[model samples]
Target chain A: MASALINVPAKAKRGDIIEIKTLMSHIMESGYRHKASGEAVPRDIITSFTCHFNGAEIFRADLFPAIAANPFFSFFTTATESGKFEFEWIGDKGFSETASASISVE
Target chain B: MRFLGAIATALLVVGAVGAAEIPLAERRSGYSFMKPDTKTMQDDDTANPGMLWVLNGETLWNRKTSAADKACADCHGNARASMKGVAARYPAFDKATGRPIDLEQRINSCRTNHQQATPLPFESRELLSLTAFVARQSQGAPIETGADPQLAPFVAKGRELYMQRQGQLNLGCANCHDDNWDKRLAGAAITQGHPTGYPLYRLEWQSLGSLQRRLRACITGIRAQAHDYGAPELVELELYLMSRARGMAMEAPAVRP
Candidate 1:
């Protein structure tokens, strides 16, 4: 697991368009290699990513092996209310991450 | 005649002193973490899966992909001739893009633009093989990069990044690979940082990985915020690493532990 950066607009007007960006560092092994002991390096990758606002799903995506080691994603949403935005990444090997940021609607 | 002889003797003495002050050639080989690691995995018996890509790359070099096109052989003639001394010059500063492009990027560009083929996805076998094939062309030529004006700033940034402390450990790349290269870390021998041989088959990785990938691993090992692939910061770091290996022979597709 590598570090990640999540950025969202500091503030947004009611019904205004808001943007969010995220980047994560991961080896994203394609299950194509072996271990130091000459055994196979099992394939492990972040299979899914999702974002929620105020406990409601806002965006989601599926990832493929072709994606680079460190993945970056950006998306836009309409702001209708103020609350918290939660981000999660699910991967093989039972790897999971959750990050959150507070949002305020003007 | 006496005055002329006296002047010649003085000049000879000065030249002798200057020569004496200069260190021996062996000491001028630049910085290196050349200490032998008893645990270093250097043989194929370790059996990294990445070696598969090199084999695949060899096939791709000879396999003709298009009707209008011939294999790499059609254009380059022979790997020994057309490819020789090429890898040593890469991660080159492309005047058109005004940025340093690594060998992987360059090979993809050539395939898309010239070979009339779709570019391979990053980290794919096709991309790895193509890169390995091209890199093998310059097996012995010394690395010679950073002469381009556009590359100077990138190299500078890379050097700065390499030395800057980061993460919870508060360690910089230089701390382990430079200052304490001869020391042990968690019972592992700290090797010198060198990019002369890359896309190397690492026993630890059990695969072949690019230098940038290795850089990302190092950052993660220290719990730092690693930059994404193709990120400006990573590119700059790559530039710095390559520059440090300037004049060293290219050893791409080299096997390592």
Candidate 2:
């Protein structure tokens, strides 16, 4: 099973540009690699990541084979109002993990 | 030039002159040699991947096993209080084996004797998780090994191995780490070999690893035969390293490139 760590501030001023950081555990193995026996090691990587604020998409990123293992994502989003931030990551082999954090804009 | 000659002749000089030891004030942790960004990654829990293993370990510590039907927490209770500074004191002398054992061996011993569970394989994710979890509890605690009189012989043996030259390259660990540290090697800085961190996140491996793994890699890099995991030689080496790095703060789960 995979694990993830996410950091989102709990509070921010209205219209503040907030930073969100997410790190997910995945081998992100590039298919180009091979085993000691000359056989190819299967490629596995997180293909996409998206963030939603109050059900509206705030951020999205498409990943590729070259991404490092345990890919980390950091981006900015303007804090418009008090709401929840939802995160989702999807990848090969039907892999998916989601987490949510709430924010209060004062 | 004389220093370079001495390193080239390290094999002959190993049993003669005592290994040139680094001064305490001059010592620097591997963390000190890392880039600003790499250090930033390590300082932020949200960014460091080793934290993932630490998270898994916390779960494993609480979950009940199949055979013993007991979790580690059942016996040790809250790890925060019970495990603090524990990792700093290994590789500890085990009278039962009449040798020193590292933290990984001690973890497996607990599983075999008390938890009735099969030992996790070396370098396995599960084992790394548990060891990282235990060691994380000792973050910032200074290493306190080598005080025990019983471990004198093993520590001596370890020092021998560290200073002896072998493999096709014919290099001892001291040649680069002790003799030429702060110098660049193939674009990477040579760090003084301090066992301050283990089960750390290495960018090269893209995974968490133990000191033994790093040692084996170093040995193989010089074209020498590597010791098997959990070998007494490795444990003894770990002992001597901990002793040599005495009072250095623990930084397991550190991120390094």
Candidate 3:
């Protein structure tokens, strides 16, 4: 969950626009290997990620095994009231992460 | 139980014998060019910060810490004599803890139990200096951590962890570093999972870091869950790495890209 914050200047004065940025870091395993006893290691990878702001759906993305580890993404959202932003990541083996940050509207 | 006891006894004897051996300079075979060059980044902009740490360690060796008012020199005398060959056997099995203990842990233990000083944080200059000082004595000596029966399981665990697939990408460490050592990812050449030279000054990190720190970086780089510093899993993995480089010499505070 290594992440950084960047302040973006808003071009649109009011409504909806997409904010796009990428995160770097996602272990995208193709799941191809032999175990200690010489058995094949199984496949697993992050499949999806989504973001919401102040309980409103804003953006979403799907990932594949080919995506490099520490998956990065860019997205957009309709400007409503500036508030809290939430991000979620869903992956194989039922792994999931949800992170949130606050945004202010001027 | 007898076999285990015998192995433990042998390990103790080896430790005792190692205490008497002269620490040699590390040998550089295939990767001689990786040695610190003038172009290598200086430590904290100081001239050869690693060397400075070693010098500070010498001072620390003689100066008594307030905790117990006992200096490393109090018991060991000249480090060139008493502490030789010690670093070459580290990442060794600690019978008391029942786990593989690296040189850093051993030093802290001595500081706490013997010298009565508070253990320095992982990357502190004091710890690093003392570590470099000790490792310098073993520069060219062959690493000789004897096999302990108790360490086998952990080594196996570490091996499994190394090859296991994890993270969003589901890539295991071995996939890139081992199997693909000769392969190119992005623009970098993937090197073998070697821990021969560690506590390295890295260009990417722009600072000195331990091998475990590097391991954590790799874990993060792969988008896998990185274990906490001093975690059992990381210790086990470190033991496995040390085993892989069984005969390699210790090259602490080395430079790396």
| TM-score of every candidate's chain A | 0.88, 0.96, 0.70
Instruction: List DockQ, one per candidate, in order.
Output: 0.01, 0.90, 0.01
lDDT of 3 by residue, A41-66 (tens): 77678888877767877677788766
The lDDT, on a scale of 0 to 1, for candidate 1 is: 0.69
lDDT to native, each model: 0.69, 0.89, 0.66
TM per prediction: 0.58, 0.94, 0.58
lDDT of 2 by residue, B125-190 (tens): 989999999999999999999889999999999988888888876777877777777676656888
Itemize residue pairs with steric clashes in candidate 1.
A31-A43, A34-A41
- The DockQ-derived docking category for candidate 3 is incorrect
lDDT of 3 by residue, B1-257 (tens): 57645533443343332212112233232244343553343222223334445666777889888768999899889999888888777678887888888888888988988977788898776787788788778766777754667788888888788877677555666665555454444555566666765665565554456778988988987668899878888888888877766788676556566
Model 1 C-alpha lDDT per residue in residues B95-206, reported as the tens digit of each score: 6688888888887677766788777776676777778777767777888877677788888988889877787555677666555445454555566676776777665664
How do the residues A15-98 of candidate 2 rate in per-residue lDDT, one tens digit apiece?
999999999999998999999999999988899999998999989999999888999998998888999989999999899999
Clashes of each: 2, 0, 27
Candidate 1 residue-wise lDDT, A25-103, digit = tens: 4668888778889998888889999999998999999998767554567799998988999999999889898888888
